[model samples]
Target: MGVHTLAELTTFQVGGPIAALYEPQTHDHLVETLRELWSEGEEPLIIGGGSNLVAGDEGYDGPVVRIAHPGLEVVPAEPGRIVLRVSAGVVWDDLVAHTVSSGWSGLEALSGIPGSVGAAPIQNIGAYGQEVSAVLSAVELLDRYGEDPVWVSADELELGYRTSVLKRHRGEPAERDAVVLTVEFVLTDAAGLSAPIAYGQLAGALGVELGTQLPVADVRASVLALRASKGMVRDLSDRDTFSAGSFFTNPIVPLAAARSLPEDAPRWPVTPVAVEPTVIPLDHYTGELPGYAPTAAPELVKLSAAWLIEHAGISKGFRLPGSRAAISSKHTLALTNTGGATGDEVAALARFVQARVSAEFGVQLVPEPVLVGVEI
Candidate 1:
């Protein structure tokens, strides 16, 4: 079979061709194709909706497995709690719509995210204060090093802010050689009520205070509207939404480092819990009970990426000389393809932005998308 170009498969629309692109329509076919590739000494690149990926101009020469199997089943669980076993290929927004329409609440905040269910847990995808980890039950995974698929609990994924065990960090291979076959989410019925609005912007839009619960449908609508305003919702006619959303993630810095920045910089504290005193064994005790010294928990602060970019002198719609790539006019965080931008152009722009931010604020911005054969 002729392969699809990464340009043809990715949201960035700037990659070169691949040796093969397999879109398996069934779970069995997906597994069999992966196994065949592995047996042939090929480690296939798995792609979902291609929303959170960036590929290079040189292109990939190996098999590219695109998970397209679609299924969503409601598993019976305890009352007021619903469990959904969703296939990997299920469009993420479609799942959100289904849950909201069914009077579910947990996924409403992540309404306009463009990706597949399979990709969500890989990054512990979150928005508007609601993360996938809040409701994830388990992931059905096909371990590349094991025989059959197994169900790994959510806690095992070690989901953190926009990261997980399945995610590959910069300059590192994927931590886990497993493919997500399905994801199970345990959501609340909520009796048509949405989860508490934790983000101030979202809360204001809903005309409620933080921790207030509105209608699930209303919450979805407000979130979609907010995302559209920021050019996050995908639209074929809108060039501002052409790029992968949020090129750089909000950087998490320690409290001391965060304080070094200007006071106006947007910052949010990630509070740490109090640590309990360690118990000493009688045989290992060296002296009297340890002095009642209280240790202050380390404080983590999330600095806004968009703020850093703007402060670094890269304004919205900023572009290099004669470069086809530019920052999105609607959002500073998005590095857009103005028109006919190559992967190299996009990567160069990303590196420029990173250099500017790092030089100005001493904060190195990291690319949020999974780059294939490309470095920024």
Candidate 2:
């Protein structure tokens, strides 16, 4: 209904007050405001849970449209499939918990991810080998360039690992013009059976072979517990949960580049051409050349950013001199505000980590959260 500061909305608790904040109670009001803003040449930022953003100390100069539009309707579109049209403003984790409690099988593994449903497709949120894109049927969007609300198929989103067309931009302003209003997902009506377990840890916890099915509720519980242990779950009391989940997307490097590492480096396949390695650093040690040399080939490899941070000698609770901001003591990836920290302080810690990781490993780490008025 009205405006609020970034410090009032975001989990980080460090941004300056926003210029304007709007929470439209209905879709029609949202469309009208958006259309007016677009016609007037205003580019408003669409905010959801404010969990995945890093607002600057100066805050946003533009209008901040909080997507509070609400609706959740389920219709049986076909046998064994239920079409769920979820409003983008719905709290994402709440929806997952609801669906699992109702015996639905699709979103159990995504149980504890913070943020709103509307923001899910913006990055195709994924974890534990299951991605929101896998069950996504279509998205309802308010087109910035056009006058009407349009329904875009999943194919239109160009969904991939932690990315979508909305995020890529592709040299056009189309992404900025589009605001997701609602999302549709196709879920199964299986009697308590969950989607096939794909992540190794989940499989081991369930005591089943990879790709085996278990009870949907069990999968949701296991996923939540796993995330909490990593400080991924949002908890205001715990400074570790102040982060925007994992700070970096796993680096996808070429297979040849992966092979150049010592025999002890851990790796997993992203594709036939790419392999992702655990975050451990290979260049921490200064030494003479081995039998293998670093390759220049364009093979793709995915490396963990957290592992690189630990290897760079930045252990948990790492602080810069006398700063109040420090890395989360529970998880290496999270940079937390231990009270009295400013946006600049948080950004400083992030840059320090990135610089150290890159210097020690020869690999650059890209931040996962969207930055407001600061650079890392």
Candidate 3:
């Protein structure tokens, strides 16, 4: 009931104050509250776990909304499948842990990532070869401009590499005008066996070959250990975890640009998997099968942003003179608040890193967080 600041709402822990805070405890209440606000010509700043946000020191001048409706229900699932419907406000990691403990075959590889269920699809959050899109089936959302609440297929969101239609980036309007209310996932019930491993690092940690399937619980344990070692998993006792994990996303550039960087810079070709040609029965065969030449996609490379930052004269744990914000000592991709750091200081550090990286390799790093009232 008293004053609450964005610092308290976000992991970054450095914003001024909110004009008003709304925490709806029920799904119906959430919709009702937002509609009422919209009717009154007020659009609140909506937040969930606040893991991927960087607010300004001056803070948001408008009202803020935090979805607090708790839901994690196992609904009707077809044979060999598990259907779990999660409310927008449910803690994402809690869902993962629950699934793993219940012998669910999916969501194990995504352990330790922060934020709420509603946020997962917004960023298409992926880690250790498993993406939320792989299991997500549909979502229910409300259109801010009075579009009726409806269920939309996951494909409608246009999920891609760390971006989705719902995500507002660089202060631009979102492609879609809707707020997610809930999400539905179709998980597997493969006798507790996980999906095939696709990440080399995770495989190495699990002491298995790539594409090996292990117990869901084991995979979850390994993922949690790996994340904790890198100071990525949030822990109250660790100052290194006081951050919005991974301040910048890995940069994707043309192969030529990638090759121009130091040979040691880690890079992987961005290639899509080939789709098998469709087969038709002899009696039902169609003529020619429609000969069409697909346009060739130019070769692009995904570069290691951490490697670039370290090589561009920015070391892990580097901090500006007299600033409390410092790059995390354990992870180069993260910018952490040592203690009492301001949002402006964080932005300054981010801009400095951007300038140095661009000057060194001509690669512009894109920030991963949602910025409010701050320019970087």
**Top-lDDT candidate index:** 1
* Alpha-carbon TM-score of each model against the true structure: 0.94, 0.89, 0.93
Give the alpha-carbon lDDT of every model: 0.91, 0.81, 0.90
Candidate 1, which segments miss by more than 4 Å at Cα? 273-297
Candidate 3 versus the native: TM-score?
Answer: 0.93
Minimum summed lDDT over a 10-residue window in model 3 is located at: 289-298
- Candidate 3 global lDDT: 0.90
* Residue 357 lDDT in candidate 2: 74
Higher-ranked by TM-score: 1 or 3 = 1
Q: Rank the candidates by TM-score, best first.
A: 1, 3, 2
Tens-digit lDDT track of model 3 for 344-369: 99999999999999999999999999
Which pairs clash inside model 1? none
Query: How would you order the candidates by lDDT, starting with the best?
Result: 1, 3, 2
Worst 10 residues of 1 by lDDT: 288-297
Which candidate do you rate higher for TM-score, 1 or 2? 1
lDDT of 2 by residue, 1-376 (tens): 4657787777777788777887887878988988987888888887889887777788888888888778899976877887999999999999999899888888999999998999999889999989989999999888778779999999999887887877633123335358999899999989878999999988987788999998999999899888998888988777788777776677677777667654655566665433344243567645544444554435466666677788889999889988878888888888877887788888899899988977876767777777777678
